[model samples]
Target chain A: MSQTDIASRLGWVAVDWGTSNLRLWAMDADDGILARAESDLGLNKINDGGFETVLRDLVAGWLPDTLSDDNSISVIVCGMAGAKQGWCEAPYATVPARPETLAAGAVKPVLKQAGLDVHILPGLCQVDDPDVMRGEETQLVGFMADHPDFAGWVCLPGTHSKWARIANGTISGFRTYMSGEVFALLSQQSILRHSMQGADDAAAFENAIRHISVKPKELLHCLFGIRAGGLVSPDGQQAGAGAAILSGYVIGSEIADIMARLGRDESIALIGAGKLASLYRQALHVHDFDAEIIDAESATLGGLRRAHAALTKS
Target chain B: MSQTDIASRLGWVAVDWGTSNLRLWAMDADDGILARAESDLGLNKINDGGFETVLRDLVAGWLPDTLSDDNSISVIVCGMAGAKQGWCEAPYATVPARPETLAAGAVKPVLKQAGLDVHILPGLCQVDDPDVMRGEETQLVGFMADHPDFAGWVCLPGTHSKWARIANGTISGFRTYMSGEVFALLSQQSILRHSMQGADDAAAFENAIRHISVKPKELLHCLFGIRAGGLVSPDGQQAGAGAAILSGYVIGSEIADIMARLGRDESIALIGAGKLASLYRQALHVHDFDAEIIDAESATLGGLRRAHAALTKS
Candidate 1:
């Protein structure tokens, strides 16, 4: 849609602002996306007073000229922008939190910019349980919207991976794993970087997953083995195998931990996309667990749209 | 001792050239230290052809003035400087390798310098096993020399921590854990750094060790708990506790792996010193394992001295 058409049709805006990036979608009354926009100004990049400016700059072209002076466009946001150190603190809604009712716990920060009614959605936290997640709650909520009666484990794999227990339409509990962070630190920053510099090797990855699943205690030993493997592994095969093995060890450990916590009987709903998703799927197959892959982008959009619709209806 | 006295008494030189630093000791026939020297120029710091130059620069003052022209001082070297990428490749002496007999595997490289006969000692490697150690082999040799009848698990803790199975006076097989590297990367490079900055907390460290022992599979989950724990832990306590917990998790996992490989019944000889050694001892106590602490510096010195004596005798 053209900017002019979006300007006229834009009744509300939906956003998913995270640590490193901000994504926005302008929507009409019928839930159609009139226009879409994004900014690299994630919470980490924007100062306390700079959120309003960044948001306005991104959506300024979507405002209709005929709108009255006092009229405001509703904007719904999720993710890190709601954290304590973010634009405005949106205190976490403790679990078991109904995904649909997240809007009730939302906070509306006072904005200097006119013609904008913004509601920042709250993240989820388990008080006594040792887990916390910001933007992932929105994705979980969106996943629930797509499958209302879904009740099982939902795995959101990323920088700090999350595994949530969804019962009915509410999130009962969740756990976070440092798998992605571990993988990144070890592969790129640790001594393993020299050996782990290459494309993925599926067979090596699967072999690692299988090895870790059977002997989880050897995880640390297996990590050092990468360096030794690099030293001994003949020329061309070393780099790719090293990287793939590292990935498998990290991801496999996470899977092993989750299985230990919540048994391996149930199938997991993997809320991820691209290479990471494929890797997780392959890992799950190696561990003998069935997984249904769900695109994270759509889940984020779906959650934001669902939240926006709910807020507008009220 | 004065340079002249050291020069007159020096019969041979002993050096431990590792990845980050080079340590040398001027020794007499009776193993009395004549002089000591060190350099920051480790194998990683120097180029292929630069090893001899750096060694000569460090020990040039120790050469005797009365020595005839073309007479060379025998310098016995150990550690990473003898690796494939170091001064010259010192082929690994595969296990079961007798620590006292490491001199048999020594590789001599012709030096450009006139007054130096440098012999690089080979490190120990378990060819079919997934482990290798360079400098630690010398320490193990010294430890074995000090305890001839000792036959058990010997741990040399550092960046790449090694656990060797010593039988009689020979290293049977061994394994390496990236415990120190994991702790360094997580506490310094990963996001956990912020929470893991302060003086050591003994209580937190022991608590993490005990927790991981019972639930070894929850290792990754406990790692994430550190981040969440940081968020909730009261101010002032977070940093130390986070550091301690990270230390516990990394060290705990290593201990857990080693215990899993070798039963928990056998005692472990911890070849380490300083704060890291103390922490490992505490971790061992928490895990119900008896650890006999040995001074690392003394062990390295002893190993180098023993190797030098053996070479001179041969």
Candidate 2:
């Protein structure tokens, strides 16, 4: 049976699971959208075991009328499912993976109470470096499906941002940004989290972009001052929450630094959540570069679907 | 039984063992000068049961008159010996620790083949943070001992650099800098590493320093461009090395930014391998700051002695 028959016969299922967030998609038999659901049921949410319970609870309402043992539910997954502790650990796919190169991914028999025949998509890995991509790889696959001709750097910005170098319809190389992690650390763990007192002020955020561009070198320096500023400056300017300052420092620095390296390119594609995507757009706009903000949900679903289709045929 | 008497009668016998470096100090009873012996036989060298032999080999002629059971020899150790995998696990001394805090570190139960009472000093741990310190803390302790009146920020630059806030006579607080580790990655791992055509030059380092202080805000931008300058720029005046450019960009930006928060009167102390120390001294000095450079060996030795005295007396 093909994806068309499968989609028309059963509900179109799509799951976008990432490091910190999990998004689920439910579509009618015609692949038409029925309803969308999202939960904090991210992989990082409840260790490893809780995924099954959480996933079941989130999708229980969408379960079809009658299910047979042989006729297992056809679903594809992306994101950290390929990680060491995800649903079914998928091995990394080497670079230059073609469209048909996509597979069910390396599978691991996870301890399961329910028999959910799930095929987690494998993220592309840069063997030469430490960078890895699971969910975004599916997104890239979707992008490929949409525009086979599109190439150059496809950027997916988030807590852990990803930069992919696409050439000749192949992902030649990619790099992961610790931007998200850095942001979290600075905002919460590190002293910089405290310096970020005025988070609500969008102006501070914009101004940070400008300041960071002009003084990108101050990134690391600003990090040290989150606490030092509180001690030496008595006005309490640095005494507030550090996240506000750290967010500015890290995000602003990332913009300036990444922009400088990427050059004044209009080729970069922006994909991520609300504030992060907006901030990225604003940063690019400041430099007079055009960035197309891709629908994050669409990207994940499209990517997941392509992987789903690819796996069904095999 | 006192250290003073044991030293007077024993001649020059000092031991410095760390993660990857070991040294033996031979001095007179009055702590006057004597021969110094060093070897690469560090704690890391003896994976299992061999540190004792390595030390003995390094100090071939420095052994006691007769390895008698009743007449035990006294030796003090400072560094990773307290670490889980070190020669002996000395454990950690919590905050508010004084020069004598780790003085009573437990002696290694295992006997050296020749039989010696080896005392390992406890490492230091911060009260508020999880960052722990080992050999470097002892080195910092030694610095405090030498400059009893010294108070302020002590910035010891190295692979894992440390910055401690010293008030009056006590080390009130301290933080570590991944500066060295970061530099190594930028220079050796990153794309920028490839662009730098040559070894680090004083002029280049100084130039980068000037750039950082000039703007202080564009530091990250400076870091990002080191790689692109070679690829995108027309003149590519950033000739020679991307690595060196990156190094300069990183080091210069680090100094400018970190120093901006520090008040003029704040004292900065540096401890590291000679070259790293010299480079840091020059970087900070050119920024119109004075720093005191200490001998790594002496500092380690002093720390060991201080801890030895503390533990034995306690």
Candidate 3:
């Protein structure tokens, strides 16, 4: 749609501003998508006072020419943009709390943009074990909106993967793992990098996941094996085996750890898309736990819309 | 001693040429140290056909006035200098084999230096488990020279830490862990780097070791905690606590894995020096395993001398 059409039809904007990237979606009165935008200007890239400018530039085409509080567009944001180091600090809401209620803890940064009423949603924190999640909370809120009576485990795999527990429309607790980040570091910078120059093999990946799932203590040893395997075993020098093994080992260990802590009896809702989500689904299947794959983008958008609805009602 | 006196008294040279540095000891016929020299020209730094020149430059003063094959100085070298990528290819000696027999597999790299007869020692490998070590074998040989009949487990802690099973003067098997490398990457390159900005705390280190030792499955989670602890727990942000926890956790996990695999009954000889050795000792003590701390330099030198003695006899 053209700028004038979008400006006339647009009701509000939904955003998921994370550590490395920013995403925005324009929505109509009935939560119908009007347009979409994104930027590499994540929380880490933006300077102290640059967030407002970046946001303004990205959404410049979608904004109406006139400016007033009464005609302001509601801008609901969820993720690291709400962090202490973000555009405006949105203090975390401690759990055993309802995801919908997170909208109430949202904070607004004073802006010179006359027609932009921005609300940055709060994250969730667990005091007992000391864990926190920013954007994933919004995903959870979105997931909960679709399955209001959903009570099980929600696994969101990424750089800092989070496994959250939801029961009776409330998130009980969650734990984060650095599996994805560690995998990238080990395969890119560490000695294991040499061995990882191959295409990913599914069988190798599955075998690694299973092996680590059973003998989690052998993690460090197995990591060295990736490099050693190339030197000593002929098959290990194959095109994609090493990369597969590394991916499998890291993901498997994460699953094994969560299973050990929370038990495997509970159903898992794997929230992610693309290869990572598929890998997690495959790994969970190896452990005899069938996980239902949930689309991450949908969850983010749904959660933002729900939060916006809550804010409007309040 | 003067160069003239040292050259007159010098019998043979013992060298430990590892990946990052090279150390040379001028010894008399009776194995008495006459003089010592070192260089940063390790295997990794030297280009093709550069080893002989680097070695010659470092030991020029030790060479006698007259040069001939009969009067040439015997140069016994160990470590990565013998690998396929090193100065010359010295094929690995597979276990269950004696460390002293390592010299029997040593390969001589042809050199134009008239007064230098260079012999590079072979490393040890475990074909079954697919693991390899180069310089550490020399340390084991030196250690075995002192405790010939000693039969137990030997722990060599460094970049690639090795745990070997020694019985009847032979290394039956061994496993390598990239704990030190992992710790370095996580603390320096990973997100955890921000949290690891304090002095070493012994108590926090020990606590992390103990925690991971028992709950080894939580390795990834605990690693994330080092960062999260800083954010949520006030004490986590305390100086040195994060560093201590990271160190303790990594070391503890290594010790825990070795214990789980080998059982905690056998005696452990911790072969290292300085802070790393001390930390390992403290960690072992926490597990009720009293490891005998052996000076690493002595072990390396001793091992070189023993290998040299074997070479001379052959």
Candidate 4:
């Protein structure tokens, strides 16, 4: 749709702002995307109290020139934009919280922009267990909306990977792993960087998966082995192959931990996209666990749409 | 000892050249230390073909101004200086190798200095398993000399912690864990740095050790918990406490791996000094394994002494 058409038809805005980037979508009343925009100015990059300006700049083309008083467009945001360190603090809805409860937890940030109803949905927090997740709760709500009876585990793989338990349409508990960050540190910043060149070897990955799964205690030893392996290998073990093995060791450790917690046979709802999702999926398969893949972007939009509908109805 | 006094009495030299620093000891014939010198010029800092000059500069004060043609001082070096990438390549002494045979594996590089006999001792390498250790082999030889009948595990904790199997007065097998490096990276470079301020919390360290030792597979999960814990804790947790916990998890994992390999009952000859050694000793105690503490410095000197004797006699 053209910019004019998008502005005229826009019912609400959906945002998934995170640590590294901001993604915004303009949606019509029918839950169809009228326009889309994004920026690399994630929470970490923006100055203090710059969220409103950043948001306005990115979505300026999608906004109508003027609106009748009280005829404001609803703007719903999920993720770090609602975090304590983001635009404004949106207190977390502690689990066990239902998908329907996310809208109630949403806080409307008072913005300088007139004729714009902005709501930032709160993330989920578990006090006694000491775990907090932002942005992911929206995805969970959307996942539950689709599979209302998914009384099992949901895995969202990312920089700080989260694994949440859904029981009777409510989140009971969850855990996070620093697998992605650890992988980056080892491959790009640590001494292991010398031995790896981002090569992807399927065989090396599979072997590491099998080995680490059986002996997770040997993780650090196995990590050093990668350097030793590369140093000793006649051809230096193709960098891609070395990287694949490193990823396997990292992602494999995460899989092993989750399986140890939630058991091996239970199927998981894998919510991720691109290379990360594929890796998680492969890791799940290696452990003989069935995984139902869900595109993270779609889940985010569906989640925001669900929240938006609930707010309008209320 | 005064410099002049040490130079007059100096019989030979012992040098431990590693990745981060260089330590040279002027020793009398009986292995009595006459004087010592050190430089930050480790393998990683010196330019290509600069090891000879760097060495000579550090120990120049001890070298006699006018020596007879055959009155050169014997300078024995160990550690990364012998690695493939270090000063001069000293091929590994593949196991099962005896302590008395290290001198045979030592390589002499012709240097510009006239009155310096330099012998670089080779590290140990396991071809089939792809493991390598440079300087620690010297420490191992020294450790064996102090306790010739000791046959069990010897752990040298540092950047790349090592666990070797000692039997029949020789190194049968060994393994290295990147625990120290991982700890440094996570506590200083990774996101966990925010939560860990390099604090030394005894309680936190002990608690994490006990917990991780029982369920080592929970390491990644526990690591994420550190971040979550800091985020949720009203005080953000004492940086020291967080760092101590991080250290515990890393070292505890290493202990768990070594215990798994060697069986929990066998005692370990812990060859380390100061903070790292104490940490490992504490971890070993927590795991209910007896650890006989050995001074790392003495072990290095002893190993070099043993090698020098073997070379001169042969």
The candidate that achieves the highest TM-score relative to the unseen native structure: 3
On a 0 to 100 scale, what is the lDDT of residue B263 in model 1? 49
Over B23-69, each residue of candidate 2 has an lDDT whose tens digit, in order, gives 77765555544567777777667878676677657655655556655
TM-score of 2: 0.54
User: How good is model 3 by TM-score?
Assistant: 0.97
Specify the CAPRI tier of model 4: medium
TM-score of 4: 0.95
Q: What value does the lDDT take at residue B228 in candidate 3?
A: 76
What is the C-alpha DockQ of each candidate?
0.68, 0.09, 0.79, 0.77
The better candidate by DockQ, 1 or 2, is 1
Off by over 4 Å in 4: A236-240, A263-265, B2-4, B235-240
DockQ of 3: 0.79
Docking class of 2: incorrect
Regions of model 2 farther than 4 Å from truth: A1-314, B1-9, B112-115, B199-204, B210-221, B260-264, B311-314
- How do the residues A46-69 of candidate 3 rate in per-residue lDDT, one tens digit apiece? 997898899889998998888588
Candidate 1 ranges beyond 4 A from true positions: A68-70, A233-239, A263-265, B68-71, B233-240, B263-265
lDDT of 2 at A122: 78
Residue range B37-123, candidate 4, lDDT tens digits? 888899999888899999988888887776654888899999999988888899888878898667799999878758888899999
**True-vs-predicted CA distance for residue A290, candidate 3, Å:** 2.1
Q: Which stretches of candidate 3 lie over 4 Å from their true place?
A: A235-240, A263-265, B235-239, B263-265
